[model samples]
Target: MNSQVFQTPIEYLKGVGTARAEVLKKDLGIFKYEDLLRHFPFKYIDRTRFYKIRDINPELPHVQVVARLTHKEILGEKHTKRLIVHAQDDTGVMELAWFQGIKWAEKNLVIGKAYIIFGKPGMFNGKAQMAHPEIEPYSPEALKGKGNVSLQPGYNSTEKLKTFSLDSKGLQKLVAILLDQFAREISEILPQYLLQKLNLMSRVDAYRNIHFPENATLLYEAQRRLKFEELFLIQLRLLKSKLLRTQKFKGNIFGSVGQCFNTFYHDKIPFPLTNAQKRVLKEIRLDTQRGVQMNRLLQGDVGSGKTVVALMSMLLAIDNGFQTCIMAPTEILANQHFISIKQLLGDDFVEVALLTGSVKKKDRKIIHENLENGKLKILIGTHALIEDAVQFQNLGFVVIDEQHRFGVEQRAKLWRKNTIPPHVLVMTATPIPRTLAMTLYGDLDVSVIDELPAGRKPIETLHFYESQRLQMFGLIKREITLGRQVYVVYPLIQESEKLDLKNLMDGYETMSREFPLPQYRLSVVHGKIPAADKAFEMQRFVKGDTQIMVATTVIEVGVNVPNASVMIIENAERFGLSQLHQLRGRVGRGAEQSYCILMSGGKLSREGRIRLDTMVRTNNGFEISEIDLQLRGPGNIEGTQQSGVLDLKLADLATDQEILLQARKIVEDIFARDPQLALPEHQVLHYAFASKNAGLSWDKIS
Candidate 1:
């Protein structure tokens, strides 16, 4: 088997000239011979059962029959013309028709000749017929040949490809040609010993059976082998990247827990740290002590005390004589962090400053000067912190809040701020399912703070329909009467003619009418509002100046008002699970019990109902995330759609967790026993890795 053949342009393959090749490349991304080979079937139709013409019904999915073309004719004018052929078996008669490819059908059909037909059955004016069915001359010897299976592989193709005779059936023919000519040239990538241990099919047999399986058992085995191989390669690559980083990068060792960390942990802390928080801090400490640049993903549910853990990690860096910074996705979050951290470190001997786009020139100049001269110990800001003028004296550690909001390239800028790339701890409030975490952040060590801080109550979630609006209003009024503020969130800021939703403006007006202005003050905030105005409203709500704050999802991440005890989400079914969870998190910050009221219309879709039910059933973010993955799939998850590793063809992240775990385990075992994969038995794996990542470098910190 030669690698060069796989790399050959797809246009050079037999039966695929330049015209068809361009269509394949443009539509399906099949530019090379190997790409075509890897384009697996989406489904397979069983052709083994031949149905009698009398038994065919419109309800049947697809059926195959052996019949003869008794009569053929062309009917209608130019655009409406069609070729109709009457076919009959010993039992009954059926009609075969073609509208688009009339000329080809007329030229190919032989009158009174027996043929095998396969297609979906349909009813047309009380007669059974098949539209544009696949017709092949009947041959008993071909059907009886060894290794010939009665399963027909179905592929995905665009309408444009159908015009050029590259539909599913045409594509299947081309694949058969490729396999007939070059199936033997396909190389076996896995070692023989591993294949024997796993009892997996050989590479060539797997490829052949995948497209044209001999039987149901062979197809199952083929799919299993290919899925295992794909996941194995991805896990192996990520593990290798992590190993290479540890071997190549040298981190500044933070070997001491000095006055700053010890004081904050023992005396200045407001409450006792949860066991989850302590565990995460210990993991970060070990990474910093190992002298290897740490790339860790800190996952915690909303209100899980991730910020305290982040601040403590920063204190550890400051204790070891290094400046630290925390980068947030939005200015509101940055301001919140700045204010909260300042209050937590009250009267402590640590200097902190905030830098953002809205800061005045004078303040920016002083902040920049202090940062460059080692006067500022901790800097908290948004994207402005990565500006060229902002230089650090010794930036040893960095924390990214809501890491998914920032692009990978933007995050990389912070890494270059120091001579030695600083240790990175990217924190996210959105819980990632275990399988997604393994694939998306496999190159980085992971830590999860799975519990909330002390005195925090699990938010009580409730579902209400449009008819229950009065009940919801009564609850809000009661909460406001108890000296608690309320947040009323809407999905859409403006009214859409296409969607029947309760917009923000309409909700605000209703609230104003329900609780009049003189006694009940209501604040409004949305994305369209000016930044200063939005800040003013947010501040008023935080200070309990307003009894009700009407807003949109922009308040999902930033607002942390402790006195806000109620979250009423209008059109709650319109939002995703993670977003609903985040909005629910806006409350339950105080020791008092909190409630999240989900209001939806009478007409609820199944998926929408599941989302709301899941929210009401559990406050655990991890449990909600797993259900979210199953419902919406991995591609729609917050940060994983753009990851290159998620471009899986044969494996599904939601349903294939068992296979993924097995692949990861095997990869780990291989690396533990043979670091370099230098043994003779593993040469095949080494070669596959080299060929797969020929021009790529695994040096970036994820």
Candidate 2:
């Protein structure tokens, strides 16, 4: 495996000179050859054969045609260099129009000459026409319809690069240079046995085929191999990091059985803790008291008493003469935490303060002074608590709510606040698939609150078609009349015919007219609204002051309105399963029989139908997550299409669950026998593993 870095800048790459490099660097963030090598295409184009002009469909975006040039004419005003050529085959005749590149195109389009043209066909002057189609001079054999382009690579380039004559084919030629020159040095990256068993193509071969495939099977194979490699690297990185943290690092151990927890359990709280809560508390107590830093993920379904458990854990820290800080992703959530903890620990002798980005200067100064002086024993805030200005006297424990919103860097920053890394507890309401959890958070220990609190009923979820709009509105009216608030959510802010559904603004207006709350007040919230305004509107619903709240997914994460027993998701099919679960969670937090009405306005795709059906069939977040994983795959779970979280080349995170389990077993055995993969039989694997991690800042494959 080649571990050496390529230091050459992009300009020095075979075809991209200084001018082309300038365009790439300025427009696409490509400053080096390495960047170009890693810039994977978003999509591909297939040009197997060209169709006759008469067979063209104006509605289609991509089309190919082959015909002979029968006539050529330059028309339009002096300022317009429009060249029009009439071409025809046995089927029909069509016009070829080139607006500016007349001289060059005309020279290539001689009368009686045959050529192949590839581009979108359109209607002009009530006839078929192709504008600036990619033209290729015909060969005698190709003119007979025998030639075919099995696959064509389309490189992602900006307009500036295109105008400069640098297109997909041009970029492909440059990459070919890199691959050809480095073939020998690019030692195979995976073990020979695993590669053969998985039927994955070699890295060198995969790269070539990804850009220029000889057949459909090869293309599929190439894509599968690349996806698997990416995913494998990610899993390896996560597992390796986890091993490093647990095996190499030490943490402050907290004892498992303590009088503080026992006393609080029997004397302090008014109600008994739920079984799930007790189980999670025990796990946290063990992890924190193990004398090693606790990096654990606490996953709970909606209304599973997660907050109470979090509060209990924080109390344990406080009892140990250590200060605890809890961070929520939003100001509203932070404020909610402040109030909940203060109320939960009423007269328990723990100081708590709320710090947010919007804190007034005077209040900020007071909080800052208190935090620095250790007077603020427990702090609850948004990202403001992470700012350097905020100091803790003895920050022993850290709790992060809605942990998915914070990235690795942000969590690390908070973890560094104490002299010793604080016992960290991260919580998330979004239930992730087991495979995804393993890959995304392999470094952290996980705790699942699988059961809801005692006496709590599951929220009833239903799906409604657009035709049932009137009935759904009536249901909401009845629910509001029954003293329960309702949330009407829209996926968009304005009407977009491209996406068949009511936008937030349009829905707000229509809802205002239909569900006229003359006797009841209503509030509106969306992304474009100011945060302060959104927070205020959310407060209205939270306080039971607003009868209905027309909102977007903005409230999908933090806002908790127990009294809002009804959730009417407009265009519910547009939302993902996990998102729907989160929104449904907003309700069902109280002791009410909450209902989630999923309303979709148009025909749902198979996946969309599955999402809505899953929501209606079950209220368990874990089940919904498995459905989501099966439908959407793990591409965007890390939030970005280009994220490097699961950089697998051959493995399918969703479908190959059994394969992953087998691989885990194999990895464990192999490590036990030869920890560094130093055996002769594992040489292929060692090279493959090292090859995958070569040149990467952090090893993707553990």
Candidate 3:
């Protein structure tokens, strides 16, 4: 057997014809002989020993017993037909039955014949039973063929495949045939020197042992080799892409620290930058001076001063005679940024504009003219900033806040706004754990602001039952009396009879009745409302015209209201830990001590209790994110799943963080030695990399 034989269609294999090949391809995505070989077993069972029928119990995983069939019968009608056979050992007897493949079993099975039966043992109606067990003739060759030292491999199959005798045992037989006929043609992927350096098993031997290993030790070694290969290749591809992009895309050099940046820093400074903020600024400054496009992921917890860092970076771009833009996920967030930036840079130095979907056409026209003419120094807005009509004059730096909300294509549109892509600084308040960041944003340099600024008190979080609504209301009243507004956030917008949850509309009604008219001015906002109405309500809340703002999760991202001292989250358990953290951030922005009261039903699930306990125990967003990752694996986390980054078959980024680090280090070292992967020793790697990324272009939203 050679390369051509390895490329042979699987239907040409013995015992497989056109129909079986079609079922195999449709059910399991196996087309050619190589596909069958690559279909690895998920688990294995030892078949060196057999258990007696009397020794078999429901607690045992899987057992093989030598038994004689005493009786055979087909019972029930048509679809309900069951082939039942009572199998007896010397000490005990058990019933073996099959509902599917009944006709095949009935035609093949004979009465009073000794067979080696293998299956899981379970108690059915107070009697031991083995349903749809693997049966073979009782002979020495049959016992030997079962394997003496090798573990039996289990294959996954579908119901359609099982109808044609292609269950695990059938598929295993097919794999065993391929192994016996063509183990020599499995091909080598890793170089001999590299394999020796890593002490990994040979590629062909690894493939053989992975399917049917001689022992547990061999299986472990085989899995290690395969997982390392997979993870190493992925990390290598990402690191190489990063290296190429850095060399290819040139960035605008902000060579001067002009008066606008210096004056704002020294004269009109609102507060001193924390050590963490200064450290991050140094990193950004170094990136801007490097003359290569800087694609960086700036991660921070809520209230960690990510906005100030973004502002200073934007000012740097302006000082260098280049325009900058800040793209926020929502219109509310965009307006907040616009107002905050305007307040911070109120001097007659830089002109700032706001662009969002709600901006009037006349204002947009003027903003467009100023932008094209390079008069606007800073433009802060939502997705509308990336429209075709929106153009920029030397857009040097882009700061995308809450970057995960925008798709990669939307971000790419912003990149195309300039000839050489603008220096990208993406910010997210959701603290991505180190393992997640490695996989999700591996192509970007990461900088984290782990410290909150001084003089900002940690928000006090407390848990309460729904029965104590009056107590919570009293606390909210006390906060309001202190000249502060409050946010009453409900998880649902409308009440539903099916769910045991509070609705925003009903809560607003109850609040109005409790403190009617002028006594308590309230503003209502929700996702279902018009954008203008929501903004109006939000503005009223911001301006202190409304004492209370009732809303849903629409305010989860970037709602900055310092006067809102109290945040009452209804049915807090209904939201995720990350979402709850963002909502808690809405308050505690002012100098006064803020409180986040979590009100929920008395009955809480285990996970819900853990979430609330974590919230109450710590104010650290990174700790909360780690716990959330453990509770719900990376797939359920908000942004990473949209891209195919976490579509892993072997290595898990959640638990295999150490392996990921090792794989990344290995890639770095390999590239350090051979930058182009052109050496003869690295030909295997070049082949693997090329094959893995065959038709996939490396273009991305840097």
Candidate 4:
């Protein structure tokens, strides 16, 4: 592409004056002339055919009609008022209404003059009407550049942009003017040989067709070419980063698997390791043995033995005469890990300590000292572990639990704790779809524990409406009578008009009424509750002191009680699929069979109904994750949203798995042949990457 033209400011464009340029820049991030060229349309409309007024229907998509206006009038008053123009073709008349720009329409639309109008049709009182339709004179001059077979592009715009006439149509005009001036200068980026091999369109033609296609075939090819290029670059960048890190970044070599890991594996393991766990451990062992820093993501559903895998990974560091630390998102989780790990180790296997803000000053100082002197073999804590005072003697391995909760910078802090970044293993209970993992954590090695521990039963999930509350209550009573604790979760702390779900407090009060004081002991926890209080309530539930716990999603991540047999989620429709899955994981942790009772209103949205049905159907995290990705897209998933990497122009991780795989394979071959992309044919690819990622940090997805 022409560098000078692309780098030129938008204000220099023919149609975009100073005022319009400011709006484009602020509202749409369109700063340069090329920005307009690359701003592809979200949808397209066929302009080849015009529909007669009598043939128009609301079921038909956006239609074009060549008609003459028979009458015009302004109806209603104040906010309800609108300008309506009656336009007639050979067969019948249709209403063209404008809710805004009434004065402009009244002045520009001439009565008894032929015009071309295009808009989506709707019914108002049994009459076909179009609101805010595009109107132009029927003369050939009015549609000079728009050809007979052209498909008009419709860009996404904000209301602010519409005020300056920079809506979809307005944007099309600016883009057309720029193309007229600079089409020749828009040189191709993908060279001719590769273009021929892929059967892809030229860069210039792709851009033009992506905006206004000549036909259906051209539009499809244009979209394919653009999506391929975007995904290819992202894959190439990710593979390059992995290469650089492995080749240059130094890692501590755990030369030996010593007694700690052996003893735990042989004598202290609570249960036998699943095949998935054993495989992941083997992968980790191979990575650490390679003498390069390891950045790996350990993803599994809750109760899939991820914690055990993390524990063994930390043991590898300890056996190598190094200290390791685990950073959890919450203090409750940190405490739980500290306690459970000690129990799992069977006492005095390795000196483990917990460090958090709640730790007393004296205990904190000693813990800090032990960490610096390398006496504390393993340490676990919340964000306080990253404080300046918490220095380590040799932080060889680091585990970040619930890795999505920490931002890239926060996780990077642990890397900075030591001179060479530690062999890092980031763990999450949320199962990420394979496509998403390729893009978001593409540079990191991913190991999935796909199987649960032996002899564990899958939680039976059921969906219920409010009218079935009596049956739900009966089930809950049966579970409590069986001596298993229960959890009733709500979605909110206070009621709002926007969401009519039950609040935690109200749910607690209602439960108290249902199972009064002495018969049933209940504890409640929510975001507003004090930390000490929350911990106390959770401990009571864990101890089976309370028959049931009433709370919000605060208990979603932490406080794992194996004996909690029933999980009742009030207004479960309000949660994302992933969240609902996590909440269900809170139960079914023990030997006994557990159940997740999902309760919501009778009227559920289409997506909500699908989510509930999905939960009731299967407990496979991967399957649920794929469905979640399809329903919510990649950005709304736990971690990818914050990275802003999902600002993809065309490629979708949910639907483009094959394209992503091909891109990755091609990149692998390229790297195998030319390690640094330093070859004759690779020069364009190199230059394109450099221009796009001038100062982009390769390791920002920590």
Best by lDDT: 1
**True-structure RMSD for candidate 2:** 5.7
Candidate with better TM-score, 3 vs 4: 4
Displacement of residue 47 (Cα, Å) in model 4 is: 1.7
C-alpha local distance difference test of each model: 0.89, 0.77, 0.85, 0.87
Query: How close is every model to the real structure, measured as TM-score?
Result: 0.94, 0.76, 0.89, 0.93
What digit string (tens of lDDT, one per residue) describes model 4 on residues 670-695? 88998876777776666456544221
Residue 651, model 1: lDDT of 87
| Ranked candidates (lDDT, high to low) | 1, 4, 3, 2
Report the Cα lDDT for candidate 4. 0.87
- Model 3: which residue pairs collide? none
lDDT per residue as tens, model 2, 1-702: 444434368887777788988998887777755566666655667677667777788998788777888999999877876999988889988898989888898776789988777888998877889998877777766544233355667778777878877677667677778767654554455667778888789876776677667777888887776666665545554555565576666776655545655666777776677777888888888888677888888988887778888877877887777788888988778887887777777765567788998889899999889877877778899998888988787788899987777776887888888888888898888887888777666667899999887767788988988888888988888888789989888888877879777888888878888866567688999888898898888887888888889988888877777788899998898998888988988888778798999998677789998899889999889988888888888886635334455655345678877656655555556566765556777655533444343332222234
- Number of the candidate with higher TM-score, 1 or 4: 1
TM-score of 3: 0.89
List the candidate 1 regions with Cα displacement exceeding 4 Å: 73-80, 145-149, 690-702
Order of quality (TM-score): 1, 4, 3, 2
* Tens digits of per-residue lDDT for model 3, 1-702: 254566678899998999999999999988877778777887788876788877888999988888899998989999888988999988888999999888788888888889888888998887889888877778777665445324888888999998888988788888889989988876566667878888998877787888888778998888877777767777777888888988899999889888888988998769999899999988999999999999999999888888889999989999998899999988778888888888888867689999998888999999999999999989999999999999998899999987777898999999999998999999999988888887778888999999988889999999999899899989988988889999889988887888889888889999899768878899998999987788788888888999998899888876888888998899999889988888999998878999999999999999999999999999998889988888888888888778676766556666777778877887888889987877788766664555442111111122
